[model samples]
Structure formats: structure tokens, C-alpha cells
Target: MGQLLVVRHGQASFGADDYDVLSPTGEEQARVLGAALADLAPDLVVHGSLVRQRRTAELLAAAAGWDVRLREDPRWNELEDLAQFAAVSGSPDGLDRDGFQQWYDAAMARWTGGEHDHDYSEPFVGFRDRANAALADVADEGTVVAVSSGGPIAAIASVLLAGDATTYGRLLPGIVNAGITRVISGRRGLTLLSFNEHQHLPPELRTYR
Candidate 1:
């Protein structure tokens, strides 16, 4: 059986000018997670092409002291949040955190509801399909670790667990930054062993954003 460990990128610069970059806390989180992952001795390390994802992968690899070259894959990148936000009406971009969450929730609900097929940046079906394909392509014989965003990580988990679109939608908000999701693929096919683990991080280090 081959092991697949999917990691959500550390906390990003939410609400900042460049949201693709990781925050200082995020860098620390990645370093801590990397040290723990080093013990696993992953045969391959992979990440999406996004800046935040790439930075997380690099930081973790360095902290782990693993010399493996990271495999860049765009299919593992996050769904387009700006596109989703634009699809909805009423510019809640300037709203407070609580207000924004409400607006964002409604927007996500509309997206996952399958109402706007042509409206999304990347159609939900395409996103789901690509996520599955990416996972299959990286199923190495030994342990494999992939650093990506929460959306792709959750999408893959939802598929392997036989969850529907609603399950996938529900998962996005709960994934902790720098959390790990483990799976095993063999003749029997992919099986999810764990989801959203961050026990290695202290209370102050845990975050979701």
C-alpha cells in the first residue's frame, strides 16, 4: 500500500494586499509541522503552484531536512475565492469578519448548490475531477506528502470517503492551517485513514484561515 499525506498550507495573509504569501505565524507553523513530518521520511514531496502552497512546501522541506525536490502541480491548487465572491451580489468585501463569514457562507452555498455552472472561475465539477486525478497521479509506492490548500485537500477526502458535494462544502471551513490528512492506496483502492490532524501544534499555533 502506498501512503499519501496531504497538508493544508499554513495561515495565509488573509485580508492583506498579497493573500498568496504566508504570514509569519504561518511560517512557524510550517516549520513545526515539517520537523514532525521528517520522522515519516516521505519518499516524495509535492505542492501546488500557488505562492502560499509553494512557500509552505519549501519551508517544511527545509525544516524536515529532506533534500527531495518538490513536485509542482497546479491541479492541487485552491479553488478561486475571488471568482466565487464575484458571483454573489452585494460587495461584502469590506464587511467585518463576522459579516464577511456570513456573506462568504452564502456565496459558498450558492456555488455548492450547483446553481451557477458557468459563473464560477473553474466549474465545481472540473475542480473535483482535477483533484481526483491529481491524487491518483501522485500515488507512489512509498510515502508521499503533498502541500496544498484546504479546498483541494478536503475535496480529495470527500471523494475517498464517499461524501457528496455538501460534505465537501462543509469540510472547507474546518480544516486547520498546516493540518495533515493521511490516506493509503493499494489494490483495494484509496482508503482514508485520518483527516485534519494537527496534534503536533500547540494551542497558540493552531489556526484556520
Candidate 2:
């Protein structure tokens, strides 16, 4: 059985003008996680096409002293719904944090309802399909680590566990920054071994945003 470690990118610059970049805390979180996972000796490391994801992988490899080749795959990218959310909710520009979360939750529901597949920024089913395909493509005969966002990681777990998008959405809030989810692929295909493991980080380092 080959192991696939799906790692959520570190805490991003939430509420910033550009949310794609990693914050100072995010860079530290990635380095700490890399040091923690150094002994795993992953044969390959991959990340989504997002800047945050790529930066996380690069920092992780540098900290871990792993010279493995890094690969990029857009199929593992997170489900983007910011534009769709704005379209559905008249924009959350002036909303507070809680208010923004409220809008986000409702927007997530609509996106996953399978109704706006035609016009959503990214179709929910297509996202799920691509996440599954990315997981399948990397589960080779060695340890593989994938750096991604919470949505794609949750979607992967939900699909492997035979659940629906609701389950995937439910997982989003709990996935810590730099958390790890383990899966194994064998004769029976992929099996989820663990989810959201962050014992490597202390309470202060653990972040969800």
C-alpha cells in the first residue's frame, strides 16, 4: 500500500487584499510542519497551482531538507466561489468577520447544491472529480505528500468515505492550518487512514482560517 499525505496549506492572509499569499504565521507554520514531518521521507511532494500551496510546499521542502522534485497539479486546486458568492450575496465587502462567514456558509450551500453547475465559478461536481483524479494519479508505490487547500482535501476525504458534498463542507471548519490527512492505496483502492492530524503544532500555532 502506498501512502498519500494530504496537507492543508498554512494560515493564509485572511481578510487581506490579496489572500493568495501566506502570512508570517503561515510561513512559520509550514516550516514547523515540515520539520515535524521530516522523518517521513516522502518520496514525492506535490502542491496545487495556487500561490499559497506552492509556497507552502517550497518552504516545507527547504525545512525538511528534502531534495525531492516538486510537482504542480491544478486538479487539486480548491473550489473557488468568491465571485459566485459575491454574485449571490451582493458582495461582502463591508461585512464583519462573522457576517462574512455567514455569507460564506450560504454561498457554500448554493455552490454545492448542484444547481449552479452551469454558472458557478467552479462546478462542485467538477471540483470533486478533479480532486479524486489528482489523488489517484499520485498514489504510487511510495510516500507522497500533497499540499492543498481545505476544500479539496475535504472533498477527497468525503469522496473516499462515500459521503456527499455536505460532509465535505462540514469538514472545512475543523481542518487546521498545516494539518495532515493520511490515505492509503492498495488492492482495495484508497482508504482514509486519518484526518486533520496536527499534534505537531501547539495550541497557539493551530489555526483554521
TM-score of each: 0.95, 0.96
lDDT of each: 0.88, 0.90
Model 1 worst lDDT window (10 residues): 81-90
- Candidate 2 lDDT, 24-122, residue by residue in tens: 999999999999988888889999999999999999899999989899999878777787678765798888989988988888888889987776667
The best candidate by TM-score is: 2
lDDT (tens digit, per residue) of candidate 1 on 12-66: 9987989999999999999999998877778889899999999999999999999
Stretches off by above 4 angstroms in model 1 are: 88-90
- What overall lDDT, based on C-alpha atoms, would model 1 receive against the true structure? 0.88
Candidate 2 local lDDT, residue 202 = 86
The alpha-carbon lDDT assigned to residue 157 of candidate 2 equals 90
Give candidate 2 regions above 4 Å deviation.
none
